[model samples]
Target chain A: MQGVRIQQEMSLFEKLNILSDAAKYDVACTSSGTDRRGDGKGIGNCKAAGICHSFSADGRCISLLKILFTNECIFDCKYCINRASNDVKRASFTPDEVCRLTIEFYRRNYIEGLFLSSGVLKSPDYTMRLIYETLWKLRQEYHFQGYIHVKAIPGASQELIQMTGFLADRMSVNLELPTAESLRKLAPHKSRKNILGPMRLVQNKREENKQEIAVYKHAPRFVPAGQSTQMIIGATPESDYQIIHVAESLYQKFQLKRVFYSAFIHVNEDASLPARTDEGPPLLREHRLYQADWLLRYYHFSASELLSEKQPNFNVLLDPKCDWAIRHLEWFPVEVNRADYQVLLRVPGIGYTSARRIVKARKFGSLDFEDLRKMGVVLKRALYFITCKGRMMYPVKMEQDYILRNILDPREKLPGGLGEMGYRQLSLFDDVNFREVKAE
Target chain B: MLKRRFICTDTTIGILSAIYDAWKMDRTDTEAGIPLWGTVQHEMFCEYYEVEENERKAGAVRKLIRERLGKQAYSDISYAILSKDEDKGTAILQTMVAARELADSHRIMEHLSHPAVRRVFEMSRNVGREAHYWEEFLRFREMKPKILYAEITPQNQVLPAIADHFADRFPLEDFVIYDKNHASYMIHPRQKKWMFMTDHEQKWEAAKELSEEEEAWCTLWKGFRKSISIKDRENKKLQTQNMPLRYRGDMPEYGKS
Candidate 1:
């Protein structure tokens, strides 16, 4: 653990800089899931789809006034920059300051709402109390109806957690790492049991509140947008399969709205952590995991279906859907005009919305290739998997190798750094072409 | 016989009136065309007639579409009228004409096989998406006397589309959003419903005078945005992709830095 340096009489500008910098590593910045209209007396409202005012240079949406209530901590987590053992500047904002900033920024359309997180200052109860007080002022006194996402501190009393959940739109408790063994290794002061305790509490309270609302018409909602959690990826030696399985259980058992995966950026040099490398955070792996995460949530795929013990990681060159489609080639050549909605979803280029549109539009008239393109289907990829009026788009063969060679076209746009990895995959075949050219 | 072309101004009432005239002249898609008043490109063998552009004719057309085509199609046609496309009037007129052939007139929007209906659908989606983008990227600065003022230069006429959202969100505050491209204003007084005004005189210099506390808050917001980004994960291409360059001119964080 590193020693913290307490700064005296910090200005609001400096406090905002230090505190928001501390909170940058906490990933969930979304303001979605809850839609609340203003009551004609309040100063703000929320949109269910969420609105992003700006995107930072890192390309992440600046949807909320994401800041820590304080940077002072008692715990010494190995991967954290604000651990007690590290020598970093510390600052805290009064509840008044947080409310004012949220109000002013939200009025200016700079943020959708406030995302308030804090370190375990003194005790979890004390920190949670401070958060509750701030939220109370923002909701009760200031009459702010906009989105509020707060962090439920692990090990806090159930009473305090329950009371705070009523005021927040969304609540989150960081799982920190995937497995209990890895959590014990990196975050010594924290335990998996302590984290899941508050998560379960929020879940049960929300269930009770739902019934209360059904009976009473207007009972104050308990985390109305639902609870979400995040875990740092690549921090522990867990495979993608294990991480996603954990996510699956969290979603099914606890009913989480989202599970964010942060590609662990090396912030501290600790013996327990992986050594520093020229390769930055595992963004490509994180990207793949999110793609698979969507598969689990929206595309009706199980963790085992996407990856098994035999293959535990996602393919770096292709997306999870395309990879799955290639491996299971038997599902190809689905008739567009007659295929069920579920079958249309499994096609490579068709999204959920496009599938729905196809289902609706085909009822009026049988759709052809041009109609599918207008309905937002990416024909470049779907041409191989789908047919129009029982005829394929082209005479392309349905062989796996043939499709893989064409699907991995250099013209296709890949996510940021993964394009280079795609080229590397193609270079394996390029070697034979190079040998032929050399002989010539 | 030649096609009958009705010319009108580029507005809701004008387009609706032209649609009324076209519907009266011919219910067939191939025989009638509606083009904007000033953007008419004279075609050979086409009889061009200027629409009267009155509220009564527009009202009758609006009532007819609402009663026959259902509320969803009516809303889609309304959004398509707000699009920036020059052929929007013709597309919508053809779409309504095509609806006459449907078994259930309300299901015309679902008939994407008709090119005219598909065109109206595409234009409506474009206008709706642009309006949503403005909702996300529009920045308001507190002007003198504590009035929130914003300016946007959107390609489509989106001021009317997004006025209700902001008015509901900020019912207690007096705000005015100026659409520079359309030269219109969406003004909402405190505790009052919003209204739209066009062809109004403007003094752009007066709106630039911000309140005393506005600069301080803007500075604080800019600092927070800067610190909230991780240095290790800086990707400018992704940043531009999410928040495009066109939207940065008015955002304080992206202004002059």
Candidate 2:
């Protein structure tokens, strides 16, 4: 372990070059998830966009230098660049190098904080120990009370993982593959057990911290941004049902902050890897996963109700809600003013924001189309499902055909629509000119 | 594409008053005409009117916004109009009119909920959210001139909100938050004015060596980072979604450690 005094050896410039270059591939540090506040001391705070910088060529936001400790590896994960056998340019940072770079970049305001991940340097614990040392120095010696999002190395020791919670604002353990069997095939060195062991430990610790925070006024700090994990969508053959099922379990069991869906991009062309070339990253599928994920997280929808092993994947044309609403048409035609909160949440057009608004405004008076619009209900989706004052806006007749035409027919998605990529690609004038290009 | 111009010396208030006066003069039977601030070609059909800087008029306009649209609405809409949204001008006007018509404590919120109002509110609210988050995410270290500097290239105009937010949140500090896309500053929290600083003036170098103390602090910071994550439920997309790469340079959460 490089002592804290290693800062004198490398200038902040050199540290930034090495660490930021190292951090470029992590694909973590999406900062909008957390809600950390400004204490009386310290100069910086968090923003929803978390101070955007630039986007990578693949249309993903480069919010942080998503990089790793070193490209050297002991494992041969088929999809990974640093897979032990690959001959890529390798780099590793002493704990001191990482600490120096972080402080330097942080000082220059070129970055938010570090998203430090590693490629099994010697072992998970060995690499994690260096990371732990780096963070310890940043927080204690520099008194840097800013955002820090670190990665929890799978199979790392419990105390190492625990120390991360105290030091960083957010941390993540990536679920690279949705299914373990597929993971075994694609990433042999990485096992389901090694990946999830530290995850479970972190889950338990955060739970304990949450309980303490709830019961007592104060508790020893945990990740204020909380713990999150990433899953590569469309890489393996796992269905959306399988993805959601795993996600729901994670949320319930581990209390994860978020479950990010990275539509797998075949960064390297490895034949052994389940080739993602034909489909690229299933951007549309990934978009649907996010919609379904949002439903699970905010709309209180259950995995069973949304999909099953029989019907594994979500339909690309229709959204999760519309698809569900169409299947269970018996639940439709609920009067806006009368439906219960959970029932209201099930409506196709109504979102958490709109549903809450509907609840508030309906208390004032019965809602009309105008009122629904005022209440932030996305009428395009809502109109097919709900009735105002017990009367459907359109003639109430054969429901399946109508719902299918409106919601399902546009699976490939019509032009000028609000579907993820379609809407953003609106005007030719709106190329890179429109900067909020993050697909998530 | 001839249009009126006003280089109001006062802040957003003066500009808003000029907008109000221009809007009043351009009323037709059905559609209202507004000279969107910077896009005019100064053609023959469109008359070019210049408005002088007037604090009294600015005050009068501020009073009207408060009386009609509530107090916070002025800043909210002014910031919205000055924001980088393509539809900023019309949105500000529509929200302003909508707020005036509603004229209650929750009027701005009511407009925030209104579809047309929400369109603008969402734009500005998003801008505001990013700016606010940038404050927390931004990591700044010391440089020459005693200025704590950070740079960003956001999708929206966020300096004002970010600057104003940093002031309340990080009071008694001297900093310059710059947007690289558009050369502007969330200027001086201490000075309380929006200004611009060129790279030459700032003389800031991005990468440098940290002090021994700083290195120690970074390691501790990473140690704290190590503890926060529960590995089981990680979602890379969600992490990327919040802390988009575009905003990373300024985020403290993802800086080096």
Candidate 3:
């Protein structure tokens, strides 16, 4: 192909542009979940709360140097921009080139670490071996102790995956689509079983490594930052209920660290995919899913509690937490001075940190609304649901419509596209902006 | 009762020395206050005193807080003293006095209902957050002779707060982080301990000379940053919200080279 022929003359600048542009669709750019000192010998360290070195125009945190090792794929995934059938510019970085870039970038403090993903080159095993070699060089030869997040090719052998896992801080295998049926329609080359196989392997190996480290204090850790996965939303017709249920089970069954939801952006057109429109990606639905995902991980909530088969979608007008609080109004007016930490968490505006702070601070004295606000509780939202010293922040009735209308004020900030929808009741006949507000 | 107000310079040792004198007075919370020098608002029926700032009195107060109120509170007070707030000194003094009423003096941080303790908590949080921001946004450039030089215009005195982090991360490299706001430098020499220097007379003209390879690497980084952004999902509001415009001045990707 012309792209292959031009690769020989491409400069490092051209290669970086093409590769990072190709890898921009990836949603996981975090450098969190690992804490390691530099050992006073290497070049970098990991902070538990990851540092965002910069942010891109898309507003995503540029924590790592997110790039594909090569844009040469054998698979013909219809949704992928770099699919084999596509005629995009293809470039591959040699192992030495990647190491040089990582070490130089580390010295400049431009990035936290490296996020090395790749397109399948020739075969899954071949691509996995290249990734392994690149990581091995970065860790041993370069003495780079910074964070590394590598992708484990779905069909790669178990031995290669385990070898790469030891050197990486995090590993991931993309679930592609939420369900297996949708996976077959969109990504014919990727099977659900093939994707879940490596995920299960990493989990089991991590468990075993934990026991090993318990016995041997300095035993080398395997995937010290744990593993995460991402799935495309709005590409298929999966409901938010189905999507989060799948995420819940993955967190429970596979013990994954994070399950990222990427709003499907139209990069390629195919017969089975949704028709392209100028509405752009479903960012509002993606935002709601992330909010609900945080609810599952930190707020001790279940997928069933947030959504169900009857209401299998998030409200475009309200967030999942506020929606839940509105539906379950019987649990309102929770006494701030008396509520348990879990109960305070269930309040609309109180977060995990604020809840903990409230629980700790109330031990000294009973908290009022001012103290609650000082402790980081959003009183404009929490006032409707909480009471301090047996009196609410405002003298308002506790009714569903009244509270919902007040909470959904036009001034309250909504995610990007949803701001134009206004505060009107959802009428069955009014589908004027249906394409924009469509919940995935 | 006449209120006794002790005044000192705006440094960690200065604040601690004021606290030492305040504690020695053993006056009630309403009768004693510690304010920074040049920021004290004189009031009637108030006896103003200039504190004799020294390392010995500061050491005594540091030891007292660390031993009585615990290391966590001591660290909080230390960070609070680094803040630019004029009332931080009085807050730390009142917070230390409040700890005496607690059954477990070490748990004074949990007494957030007290206004002075809460003020200390807020100031420490603000200083620590600014320090963390410096850790993320400070960009190092390769200067002549292979020295890594970075310049930051931080709002607080965060050079001391972030010195250990950068020193530990780049132990083998010689780097200098100059704080433009504080007129100081944190110099970490190769394989040696990091030290703070406040020599305003030192010429910095030579440090501006960049290495030959610096521009090339910066161009590559700028290109990578531009391409990695998905144009269809561009949201300048969110971008500015995540990385504020103030931090963009030192970053090469945001530079106009």
Best candidate, TM-score: 3
Q: List runs of model 3 lying over 4 Å from the truth.
A: A1-7, A422-440, B27-30, B200-206
Q: Which 10-residue span in candidate 3 chain B carries the lowest summed lDDT? A: B198-207
lDDT by residue (tens digit), candidate 3, B1-257:
78889999988889889889889887356457887878878889998889999999999998999999998898998899889899998898889888898899999987888899999999999999999988888999999989999999988899999998899899989999998888888889998998877756574443778999999999999999999999888998999998888877888887778
Give the number of the best model, judged by DockQ: 3
Q: Locate the minimum summed-lDDT window of 10 residues in model 1 chain A.
A: A419-428
Docking model 1 quality class:
high
Pairwise TM-score winner, candidates 2 and 3 = 3
Q: Model 1's chain B TM-score? A: 0.95
Write candidate 1's Cα lDDT for A1-440 as tens digits.
Answer: 97465447989999999999999999999999988888888788888999988898899999999999998899999999999898888899999999999999989999999999999899999999999999999999999999999999988999999989989999999999999999999999999999999999999999999899999988788999999999999988999999999999999999999999999999998999998987789888999999999988988888998999999999987899999999998988899999998888889999999999899899888999999999999999999999999999899899989999999888766776564454344454444566777899
Better of 1 and 3 by DockQ: 3
Compute DockQ for each candidate against the true complex: 0.80, 0.11, 0.87
Residue B114, model 3: Cα distance from true site in angstroms? 0.6
Q: How do the residues A1-440 of candidate 2 rate in per-residue lDDT, one tens digit apiece?
A: 85242224544344444444444445565766555555545434565445544333334444453456665668787776567777655556666666665555555444566677877878888888888888888777766665778898887888888987798778888888888898888888778988788788777777788889898866767887778888887667788898999999998988887888866656556775665444345667778888888988999888998998789888766788888998998888788888998989999878887777677656544778877775568777777888989887777564788668765443544321133454444566645743565653
Q: Assess candidate 3 and give its lDDT.
A: 0.91
Model 2 native-contact share: 0.15
**Better DockQ candidate (1, 2):** 1
Which is the winner by lDDT between candidate 2 and candidate 3? 3
lDDT of 3 at B214: 98
Q: Chain B alone, TM-score of each model? A: 0.95, 0.68, 0.95
